[model samples]
Target: MSLRDRVISTSVESSADPVELLSLKNPVHFLALGFGSGLAPKAPGTFGTLAALPLVWLLIQPGLWFYLCLTLIACLAGAWICGHAARDMGVHDHAAIVWDEVAGMLLTMFAVPLNWSTLLVGFVLFRLLDILKPWPISYLDKHVHGGVGIMADDILAGILACVGMHLLLEMGWLT
Candidate 1:
């Protein structure tokens, strides 16, 4: 096979132990791996999102503009982070590269009231939207490629979750 073909087909061998990822020596891999939350044997996405919660709570305390600028930075930089990490792992969008979820959750909680109720509701909504991959989110997940592709679906899911969450609050449905 050609070098290009070989590179394109590169992916994590099934026999490799998932926990070995925790030994990643690279910084980008560490961040893209969601600080090891993606190392979880199951539901690593959920764990990655959960790991982002405390971070959001702390960061959002400053105000919306600060939170937004930071989230944008994270999202933009995360594309690179995830891309390099995936390449290192020899996989495309490995289950472990969940920094996308961090950016997604940040977007989901953006401008929303920082209360337990809103946080809980938004968390559920984000996970549901991400898992379900409704509409354009699903389209992006299927059609897009590379690190941008990995992050795009979660970003769309985050936008949807943000819209759903804000509606819930505005309508006084969840408070």
Candidate 2:
């Protein structure tokens, strides 16, 4: 049955071991769960973003166009990846479904030099915007629904963080 056709379950909300039901072997789940990083008991988003760092480092190696292209591809595919996992879990935007975080991290690092300083700053900014949910970010988070909804706020957060990172770099603050 389609997700809309069935009643959403409270199991995700009530169960203590929601991760157990999901398999890492499933490609969609693997991606949606941030390559198993989302399985973290607490602060799954943080863990998920952390998991993206190495990937981001490697992604940036191919130059700006390559990084941008891959990031775009990831963003496009994220909706289906996250949505499918959410459907299987009978939840919308489950905590363990952190593909959004991965995409957000990629966005956060956009056009920025990858280094310890930039990585640390980008990580903080993305997490803060994501956690705080200020203004339109909060609006998108609340108003949007489904996988796109799940991704929208983080996307904006990443963009904002990217802007912030650029500002810092331009001002010689991040260097």
Candidate 2 residues 131-170, lDDT tens each?
9999999999999988898889999999999999999999
Q: How does each model score on lDDT?
A: 0.84, 0.89
Estimated TM-score for each candidate: 0.88, 0.92
Candidate 1 lDDT over residue span 1-175, tens digit each: 7533444455333556433444457778788988878888899999999998998998888888889999998888988888777666666788888999999999999988888888898889999999998899999999988888888999999998999988888898977
Number of backbone collisions per candidate: 0, 0
Instruction: Give per-residue lDDT, candidate 1, residue 12.
Output: 36
Compute the lDDT for candidate 1.
Answer: 0.84
| Pairs of colliding residues, candidate 1 | none
Candidate 1 TM-score, true structure as reference: 0.88
Candidate with the greatest TM-score versus the true structure: 2
Give stretches of model 1 more than 4 Å off.
1-14, 18-25
